[model samples]
Target: MDKTYLEINKQSWDEAAHRFFGRNPLPDYGPLAPSEDELNLFGDVTNLNVLEIGCGSGHSLRYMDQRNAGELWGLDLSKKQIEAAKTVLKNCHSPVHLFESPMEDNPGLPTNHFDIIFSIYALGWTTNLDKTFANVNQYLKKGGIFIFSWEHPIYNRVSNENSTLLFNKSYHEEGSYYHEAWSEPAVMQQYKISTYINTLINNGFKIERMIEDVRLTKEDIQRDSNRWYSYEKAKALPTSVIIKSQKL
Candidate 1:
């Protein structure tokens, strides 16, 4: 029998996890998205409980620690990633808790607990968004904030050729796909933008802000245009989406 996508992803990360250490971390949300310094999303995090979903290598957890957050907690499906996070956060000033488990599972985290929960380019890995959102809703306090950033849904459906952007895939089609651009095959979900917002609303979250702006710097633009995700392509359209929601 074929292995599950979850299993495949985990296995792939188990081997290649070190390559992504501290990649696309906080202070900045994700690739080309605005910095928290500009957006100030989680202002004054001092002594506040924080949890991270898909916290790879504990880079964001380290950011939370630097902010003097009360409790630093994270969960990831890859065991090796969790180990790397443990090493990264072993000397944190605040309490650090790491769990190796799928975001789809309950993992027995305290309900209505976290003051702020965020995922950086991580939520897209979930096979079941409804279950994941339901779990996130269950874990957050009323009025607590949830911030996450991921590759824009439309970014998946478009490609650039000779400085021209072309829509090659159906934006309406939503499901799992094998993104072979990585060294390993990445089995991830592709959902319409509405699905994300509606799912959050359905799970009792009030959308605070939905930012689709491209915030690439001059240095980012100076990168080679022939690269997989060219700065020119990113400038043409939003490559990342950052959504801030509050549990209600």
Candidate 2:
């Protein structure tokens, strides 16, 4: 039987979680990469009901909780990632409802329950943007905010190894792209920026803010010379994009 994309991703992430947890301690927000804090995307989440789509060990969930967010919930496709999240939450005396499910499949979460639905570097893994956005719209309360971040479409246009910032792939190509450098091969969808905006608008979301985070400093490059995608390359292009929208 052929494996589904979700199944392949689950296997890869599960293995990654196992290996990652073995070597590292529970992660905080910034060290994973540059954070959304600089943008202040979800301002003052205090007492707001928030859901994270691809919560991955619940670091971001915990971060929100610490910021005094109310009724925190998280969803991830990988069981190992959920397990790691549970462990971290338990140690911190934080209670969070974590669900193991794909974002596109409607994971039995209550409709009109969340004031905010967000993800960081996760939604790109979703194969069906329309279904995913529609599902998110259902779970979010009317006028609730939906914020997410993903690898910039432009970043994928260049060869992963090239620091010269040359276009290796057309920006219009939307399909599965494989990462060969990881210990476990990983696959992610490449979509034009318009696809995300159009899908959200079609699903009843109004765009509030959109940011392309390409803030690379000289210190950042000098500090991480051994990095595979160096700061020089990142400085020349947008590395990630963050979108903040509201359900209309």
Candidate 3:
């Protein structure tokens, strides 16, 4: 029998948690994207109750602490990640709460309570988008905001080869798929850009803003092709999408 998605991802993240402790944190949306200092997604987070899903290593929560949020809560699927978050947030100023749970399932968090809930490069880990976003809605108060970022739906289909860009896979194919020659036992889902927007709308969220621009200048694009998600490739198109929505 094959291992379940949750089981496999939990094991994978347990081993990989150390590499991601403080990487890709807040103040940045995603790979090669503009910093939050410029985007200002959550300006004046002061005294706001905030929650983070897939809160790997808790660095973003610490950032919220520095911004003086009223309370901080986070959850992740991996035990190693939850433990790392605890360690990372031990000395933080804000009152902190952490849970070990997958985003696909509810974990008794207070409903209609949080002022803001965000996930940084982590919403992609959810196996069920509707369930995940529904839980996000249940946890947030009326007019509260939910912000998340993920790799652009089209990023995986384009390749930079010998100074030329090539489109490989069919972009319309959206489902759970994995690269054959790649490593890691975990699986990922491919979503059409519109799929996310439509799903969030169905989940009772009002789309506030969506960002897909990579905001890089001539100096920022790298020539190296060996790197996974090369800046050269990201310069041609957006490597990630950031969305902010309000609970309606």
Per-residue CA lDDT of model 1 for 9-29, tens digit only, reads 888778779888988799867
Off-target runs (Cα >4 Å) in candidate 2 are 1-3, 18-34, 91-94, 160-163, 222-226
| Cα lDDT, model 2, residue 91 | 47
TM-score against truth, every candidate: 0.95, 0.87, 0.93
Question: In candidate 2, what residue range of length 10 has the lowest lDDT sum?
Answer: 23-32
Model 3 lDDT on a 0 to 1 scale = 0.86
RMSD of each: 2.0, 3.3, 2.4
Clashing pairs in 1: none
Q: lDDT of all predictions, in order shown?
A: 0.87, 0.76, 0.86
**Regarding TM-score, does 1 or 3 come out ahead?**
1
Per-residue lDDT over 80-177 for candidate 2, one digit per residue giving the tens place of the 0 to 100 score: 99999888677443457889988878777999989999887788889788888999999999999998887788775775444355778788888787
Residue pairs with backbone atoms closer than 3 Å in model 3 (clashes): none
Worst 10 residues of 1 by lDDT: 220-229
**Top TM-score: which candidate number?**
1
Q: Candidate 3 on 1-248: residue-level lDDT in tens?
A: 12387887888889788878888788877767776888999989999999999999999999999999999999999899999999999998899999999998778789999999999998877788888889999999999999999989898888778877888888998877653433567767788889889989999999999999885655434421236667678768888899999999
